[model samples]
Target: MRILRCLKRTPGIGIFSHNKSLIQLKAYIDSDWATCPKTRKSITGFSVYLGESLISWKSKKQQTISRSSSEVEYRALPATTCEIQWITYLLHYLHIQHQQPALLYCDNQVAIQIAHNQVFHE
Candidate 1:
């Protein structure tokens, strides 16, 4: 596509570190609850950062409509987690070892709590 060609011509965003010290990978995930007025679907977004450098990010509308804000945020997490996992694997294959236990940040406190709980709720 035209946009892809334009992107290929442009320089990519990157950071150069002189020391090349070990840095932890962190991801922040969020969702816009019912952002689509017509479809009533949530928009999920997440950005992964290695220290201060931006690594990966994506924003897309969900296929299924979420009933609550908590549900919307929760739905966004799995994709973000998968992305981080893939990145981690790639780093390992490249002989790069990062800090253990990558941190994931989410805005919704209720969703975070619910994710940790084992009790099922309807």
Candidate 2:
């Protein structure tokens, strides 16, 4: 079975008052390649949050073997986007003010194209 992992705990705070406002939250996502010894496929994952609170995260293996690193990263986009949408919905439910368009970062160009163009990779 493929596994999806997400980091939930907030970081960067050693000791702070609850009354203090959190200015920002940073999420770092990576994969575990050691688990699948046979396939050696990297396990991809992502995280989402709002101001010092972890709202969402996910880590999972690729459904199919990717020919190259770009393909693996491209496959991870949909999953990441789904998490982002979920976090956005949660923010809306909590009535947190935010900008109209949310900014997403990706190192892969193919993955970005896949998210923007529906006809891509079809």
Top-lDDT structure, candidate number: 1
* The best candidate in terms of TM-score: 1
Q: What does candidate 1's lDDT look like per residue over 2-103, in tens digits?
A: 323554677483345446544778999989999998999999999987666677889999999989999999888889999889888877886977766788
CA lDDT of each prediction against the hidden true structure: 0.83, 0.58
* TM-score to native of every candidate shown: 0.82, 0.61
Candidate 2 yields a Cα-based lDDT of 0.58
Candidate 2 local lDDT, residue 59: 77
Clashing pairs counted in every model: 0, 2
